[model samples]
Target chain A: MEALVALSIAVLTASGVWLLLRPRTFQVIIGLSLLSYAVNLFIFSMGRLRSNAAPLLEKGVQADPAALADPLPQALVLTAIVISFATTALFLVVLLAARGLSGTDHVDGGEGRQ
Target chain B: MSFLADHLIITPILLPLLAGAAMLLVNDRHYRLRAALGLVSTLALLVIAIMLVQLADVPAGDASLGRAYLLGNWPIPVAIVLVVDRLSALMLTLSAVLALCMQIYALARWHRAGLHFHSLVQFLLMGLNGAFLTGDLFNLFVFFEVLLAASYSLVLHGAGQQRVEAGLKYIAINLAASLLFLIGVSMIYGVTGTLNMADLAMRLPDIAAADRPLLEVGAAILAVAFLVKAAIWPLGLWLPNTYGAASAPVAAMFVIMSKVGIYAVLRVWMLVFGPHAGASAYFGGDWLLYAGLATVTVAAIAVLATQDSKQLAGHSLLVSSGTLLAAIGTGQAGVVGAALFYLISSSLGIGAFYLLIELTERNKTAGADILAVTWEAFGEADDVLPGEEEVGVAIPATMALLGISFILCALLIAGLPPVSGFIAKFALLTAAFNPEGLGATGEPISTTGWLLLAALLLSGLTALIALARAGMKIFWMPASTRVPRVRLIEMAPIGTLLILCMVLTVQAGPVLRYTQAAAEELFAPESYVESVFGAPRAGELPQEAEL
Candidate 1:
């Protein structure tokens, strides 16, 4: 399970970085999304890959931290995912605006392309 | 007053947040209402920040009393804590003062250029104050995103073609940096099992030898994320263009954003890795020093080459960041104190300069833009003649005031005499030279120290020449340009910032003492950890066994 998670993260990051270096604005946005996904997964896996464990405890029950999945990293990953989503939306709008203004999908606003 | 003082640490974060949310609900057309609300909240924040400083400055003997407030009453290490030590309080006050000034300046015109300008500024303040006061790493990342999100919108506030272009690159770069921030943070948490900074510091020493390399890798990655924000070299290429493209007030507020990165480096590096962390002491010290110097060199050269006032200010910001980073890398308490003073002086000076740029360029035609483009394409527009010379127009009174402000700013940026800049540099140099002041190890100044000094002097010289050249062209060489119609509202903020710089000069003794004390407190993280965790609960790790 650990190897699979690590391998997937590596693949996502490699592809995201490759796309991020492309000249096209759309590619960059997609790249950012991919990178964010990898980051979110990484953050989630920080809890040490717990399975069939509760993140919460019952009332009046003493908490056995070792038996429970760490809830903090899950919360952090959730927050990060929300933030990345909002930022991606904002980036898409910015991409469209750039296209409209500069008449190109290039990241440099077609400054050097011309 | 006592009640207010007890909750003071949270007010800086909460006030701006609530005000921003409330401002969002107000109709966009209701400019007056939004402005009034922003003004009241910022003014109140200024007062609260001042009170927090006093609160944090409680006598050393009574230091353990009334500082750290654990949120939700969860015991130390488990709950989110808000600490109001001298450093956090000082940073909060500086940011509050800048926000108030920038907001006031924006009210004159920039606020009307876009929807929700006031709200975004308020939200940016909320992010900044939260980042400064939060005691946990995850909370810091959350606040960082909040501020970056606000900045993304604010940078595009004016919505010009240039702004949109620059904004795209800025957003992409910062988003990437944020991803790194998350990965680094999670890695650290995975290795350490904690996200609270003080708790991490306490636990770092005991981490098994096998996990040490992984922790170091996580820390180094985290530093990369911060250095990108701090505008260290290679990673900071986006800064000059982005900052130059931003509207004046937004750019002014951004002067603090880079410092946030530097503050993180100082706070986290010094606390967790300083002197403690048995195997990990001085982890990234050399990298910070050299990269900082490289950043300084790049900024200095850029300063010499920049044609526009805004770009110059941006490069100057980089220089300031580099200097602070290098100083912190020295690990000398006195140098850090002096750099703290320099940080305040230079940030205020550069902020005022950014504000001054728009006013000075107000009178120029499209000639400035043409010159900028030509320089960009051809790398020096010597062939281009000075655009049509007009007959001499009578110089307005505002011109002289602006000229004086420009000179003061130039002097400050260049680290010339008779300002706080010179005092700061002098103090840093003296501390570097004094072997006794270089911590208890008493190590002699290394080659890096000499390189830093040379970089400082050379950057100052480059800054002087650049500012002089730019100032001469704008103020004196422009034969017949019309005087920019500066308003009192605009002039007042610039004057206030300059006066604040002047106050730093006049009260250098007390100010230096304060920063020195702050630096002392920062270096001695024991007090900080204990204060946050409480005296008795700090070293007791039985709870950790249960966990």
Candidate 2:
């Protein structure tokens, strides 16, 4: 289970990093978004891999308590996803403003892009 | 019924956050209302700060666990924890006061710059207060981004060619630094499996020594991000140019930006590394010492070469930061204590100094008044009269008063005796030379003595050179004759900051001593951990955080 989750993380992160190297502001923003998703998923999976098991501990169920996934990492991942979404939106607005004010969205042209 | 004890944890963070939200409700573009609101909120923060400072003077010096109501009683390291120790509380107070001053200063200077100034400044306060109080690594990052986003707008408040150009560079570098910060936190999380700082402090010491190289790398990278933010050494070149063009209040407010980095370095290093293996195994702090020394020497030279008012003040800040960093690198309990003391004084001193610089810059006195003064002071002052005094409002046309203020500002920053600048430096130098404490950078008493002596002497020389250049041109030399009038609103914040600085110096015995104690708290945070997360769970998380 760890191996499968690790493989998925590896693939997603690789793709995201590749996209991040793109030249345009739009592409860079997209890459950042993708990377954020990959990170959120990767962190969530770190609490020990669980397959087909519900995260919640059920009442009186004969379950391997040792196999239960850690809830902390799951919560952390949820928070990160929300924050990244806000950041991405803010970045988008900044990008649009930069393009409007300076006639370009590239990092080099305008001194105003945040 | 006991509001201070019960609500202390979240009050500093909540006040500015809620105020910023409520501010949006009042969209009156009138400067008077905006200015009043800004001042009232600032005064509220000042009250919060003083109350917290009083609490720190108690036996604890900082609260342990459960001082205030935790949100929903989830407890620390599980739900968000807001713990205010002596150091964090003091920083919140000082940063808030300076921020408030900047807002007042801005109201007078940029009457047409729009309502964003008040909102952004208030939000920035939220970020500053939050960073000081947060116990989680991710929360620190969250607060940092919040402040930086607001700063991006403030830095480019005018959107002029210079401001925009500077803002662009500032944003790009900071964004990259933010990314580095994220990556570092992620790496630590990947290793330790938790984000709670107190938890990480406990767990870090337990990590096997042989496989701990990754921890160093992660710690260093995180340190670098903060260092970049603080504008230390190679990473700080972008600061002077960015600051040179900002409006006075905006520039003055940046005094806190450097403190944020210094706080992070000191916080993480003292809390995570001192008790753990990082300090001893990595450079034995020799590199930190050298970096601090280099930053000081280089910055002094740069300040000497600078011509502009804001730019000169910028160099002085770098020098102060370098001094503080060097003291931290010494790693002695005494040195850290002194460094903490210096941090408080310098943070306020630089803020006040920056406002002074802005106040003067705005006052562009006409060449006529400058020449008249030059002639009056030095009996026609050599053969350098290249311009004539113009016939205008004789009492300085509003702008000349600002220039006069600049001379005072330069004197204050230069560390001449009687001003707070001198008092601030005296404390730092005394700390560096203390015979029994973090005493003498591991060298013989005499050898270390000379090094301290040299640093003190050089700082004095730097001040004198800067004064001669600024004074001769500004007060003694003929002005260019066509100066712009500086506003009264601009001078108010600068004056307030300077007066506060004077008060800090006079009461140095208590303030400096408190900072020293706070530094000790930072260096040995066993109590900090217990105060953050309950003693029971304190041992559970952060080892992976040092990853």
Candidate 3:
């Protein structure tokens, strides 16, 4: 299970970086979203990828530390996801504005002949 | 007053947040009320920051190293903590001073140029304060995003073609950097099982040798994110364009933004990788030195090539950042103290220069730059008609104020005599050359030291030449320039900032003492760790608090 999750993250990151280098703004925005997803999964898996384990403690009840999954990474992942989502939205609006003003999708504000 | 003092550590962050939200509900047309609100909030922040600095300036082994505020009354290492030591307090004071100046300057015209201008400024201040005071790494990330969001809006505040274009590149690059920050942070968390900075520091030394390489990789990636923000060369290519394109007040506020990266590097590196970190001691020091020297070299050359005063200011920021980075790379306590002093002087100068650029360019024709360059390139002797020169006319009052301000700004930026800039550079150089308290060691200066010294000296010289050339064109040339209608509201902020720099020069003795104490506290992390962990949780005795 850990191997599968790690492989998926690697693939997502590779593709995202490739698209991020592309000249188009839309591609860059999509690339950012993809990169964020990979990061989210990576942060989630940092808790050692436990299966069928309780994530929280019962009130006034003692629980074995080994039987429970690490919960901090999950919280961290949640925060990362929310921030990335907002930034991606912000990036889209900026992309549209840049296109409207400069009349080009290229990142440098110049028309690419290619 | 004592009750307020107990919570003083959190006021710098919360006051701005509440003020910004309140300003949003008021109608934009009610500019007077909004401006008043913004002023009150910023003034309060300045006062609060000063109080915090005094509170944090206590010597080591004092009962309370600083005031630590834990949110939600949770236990240490679990709840979010805001720790204000000497370093954080010093930064808070600088930030609050800059924000107040920018707020006052923006009131003249820039605030009306966009929606929520005052709110955005307030939010940016909140982020800066939080980032300075937070003890958790993840909380720092959250604050970083807050500031970046506000900055993006501010960069495009005027909605000009140049702004939109520059804003596009700026947003994209920072988005990528944010991703890198997350990956690096999470990787470290995975290795250490902790996100609190002091907790991480405690855990670093105990990590097995087998996992050390992963830890180093995470740290290096994290350093990359910071270096980008710090405007280190190659990674900082976005700064000149973005800062050059931002509105004057926004650009002025951004002078502290790059320093945020420097502060983070200093805080994190000293805490987690100091001498106590076993194998990770001084990790990435060499890379920091080389990168800083390269940034300085490039910025100096680039400063010469720019005709626009705003771009020149941006490049000067890169120079300041580079010098600080190199100073940090030296791993010497005295040098870091000098760097802290230099940081204060240069940030104030650059902030004042950004505000001054707009006023100085108000009356000049758009084509004046092109005309000047053309005249220099091909000798335009025909345009110099005889006897039409008004060389001996007394300068207008407006022109006089602008000229004096411009000259003072030049002196401060270029590290010339009779200003804090010269004092800062002299202190930095002397400290670099003589590493005091090293047990009478006669070791020669390393090759890196020579390179750093050369970089610092040459950058200063380059700034002097560039500013002289630019100033001559703006203030001394025989161009058909009209006297700008300067407002007292506008001119007062610039005067205030410059006066503060002069105050720094006059009070250098006491300020240097404070910074030296702060630097000493920084090199010794045990005190910081103890302070964070020693704070009492609500409803519990101090001695009962535990992880």
Candidate 4:
């Protein structure tokens, strides 16, 4: 499970970075989304892989910390996910605006005579 | 008053946040109420910041635990904590003053150029204040995003072809940096199992030997993320374009944004890698020093080459960031104190310069700067004698005011004599060259010290020349340019900012003394950790919940 997660993160990051370097704004936006997904998973996996374990404890019950899944990383990952989502939406709007104003989809707004 | 003082630490963050949310509800057509809302909130913030500074200054003895407020009345280690130490209070005060001045300046005309200007400025302030006051890394990331989001919208506020293009690059770069921030943060969490800065510091020295390299890698990546914001060398190439394309008030408000990165680096480096961190002490100190010098060199050269006044101010920001980064890298308490002084002086000067540029360049044709450069290159513009201009033609008040403000800004940014800039550089060089304090002098300065001295002196020289040439082109050529239509409302903010710089010059002794004390407290992290751990929870905890 650990190897699979790590391998997927690596692949996503690689492809995302490759796309990010492309000239088209659409590709860059897609790249950012991919990169953010990788980061979110990386944050989530930091808690160490646990299956069939509770993320919380009863109000008055005590349990060894190792028996329960680490909840802090879960919370951190959730925040990261929301923030990335908003930023991606904002980026898309800007990308579309740039395309309209500059008359190109290239990242540097393309080479065109004004 | 006593009750208010207890909660003063949180007001800087909360006041702007509430104002921003409320301002969003108001119609943008109601400019009067929106302006008044911004004004009242910023004025109140300035007052609260002053009170917080006073609170931070109370001598807490050896146990100099700063004022720590755990949110939701939770215990320190696990809960989000807001700390008001001398360093943070100083930053809060600086940002408040900048925000108030920028807000007033925007009131003249710039605020009408876009929607939700007031709310964006208020939210930007909230982000900056939160970044400074938060005591945990995760909260820092959140505040960082908050500021970046506001800045993105603010940069695109007066959306033109240039602004949109520049804004695209700026947002993309920062979004990448944000991802890096998360990666580094999560890596650190994996290693340390704690995100609270104080708790991490307490636990770093005891980590297993096998895990040390992982921690260092995490820290190095984190530093890179911050250095991008601080505009260190290669990572900072986007700054001049982005800042130059931003509107005047937004760019002025952004003068403190770079410092946020420097502040983060300083706080994290001192707490997590200071003397008590054992084997991990000063993990990346050498990298900081060299990279800082490189940034200074490149920025200074770029300052010489920059033709536009707005771009010149942007380069000046890079210069200040580099100097502060190098000073912090030195790891000397005295140097850091002087760096703090330099930070305040340069930020005010740059902020004023950004505002001044819009007014000064208000009437010039778009190609005037390039044409002037060409004329100078061809030696067509001769040096006009003082006697030539004295043919019974008195200088107009607008010209005189603009010229005087321009010269003051040049002097301040160039670190020339007769302003706080000179004093700041003097103090920085003095402390850096003599790191052993007064009594322990006579140890020869290191090679890095010599390099720093050269970088600073040379950078100042370049800045002086660039500013002088730009000033002459703008002011000396009366035939080619018209006197910009200046308004009292606009002029007063620039005057106030310059006057504050002068005040800093006059009160240098007391301010330096305060910064020195702050530096001393920063270097001693035991008190900070103790304060965090010692902060009382609001109520008794359940038996099972007790640690």
Counted clashes in each candidate structure: 0, 13, 0, 0
Cα displacement (angstroms), candidate 1, residue B340, comes to 0.4
Clashing pairs in 4: none
How far residue B224's Cα lies from its native spot in candidate 1, in Å, is: 1.1
Compare candidates 1 and 4 on DockQ and give the better one: 1
Count backbone clashes in candidate 4.
Answer: 0
Query: Per-residue error at B398 for model 1, in Å?
Result: 1.5
DockQ of 4: 0.73
Each prediction's fraction of true contacts recovered: 0.92, 0.04, 0.81, 0.75
Candidate 4, B1-547: lDDT as tens digits: 7667567778888999999999989987798899999999999999888988887887756343438888887766888998878899999999999999999988766687778999999999999999999889999999999999999999987676677878998999999999999998999999999999999999999999899998888888888889999989989999988988887888999999999999999998899998899999988988888888889999999999988788899999999999999888888899899999999999999999999987787656535656453233112111211122322223359888999999999999999888999999999988888888766777788887798899889999999999999998788864346676777888889999999999999999999999998888889888778777876665577554542
Which predicted model would earn the best lDDT? Answer: 4
Q: Give the DockQ ranking, best first.
A: 1, 4, 3, 2
The digit string of per-residue lDDT tens for model 3 on B266-319 reads 998889898789999999887887888889999999999988787899999999
User: In the order shown, what is each candidate's alpha-carbon RMSD?
Assistant: 5.1, 7.6, 5.6, 5.5
Poorest 10 consecutive residues of model 1 chain B by lDDT? B377-386
lDDT of 3 at B128: 95
Where model 2 places Cα greater than 4 Å from the true spot, the runs are A1-55, A59-65, A104-106, A110-114, B28-31, B61-69, B276-284, B363-408, B435-443, B446-460, B482-484, B533-547
**How high is each candidate's TM-score?**
0.93, 0.83, 0.94, 0.94
Q: Give residue B457's lDDT in candidate 1 (0 to 100).
A: 96
Supply candidate 1's per-residue lDDT for A61: 71
lDDT of 1 by residue, B154-257 (tens): 98977867788889999999999999999889999999999999999899999999998888888888888899899999899899889888888999999999
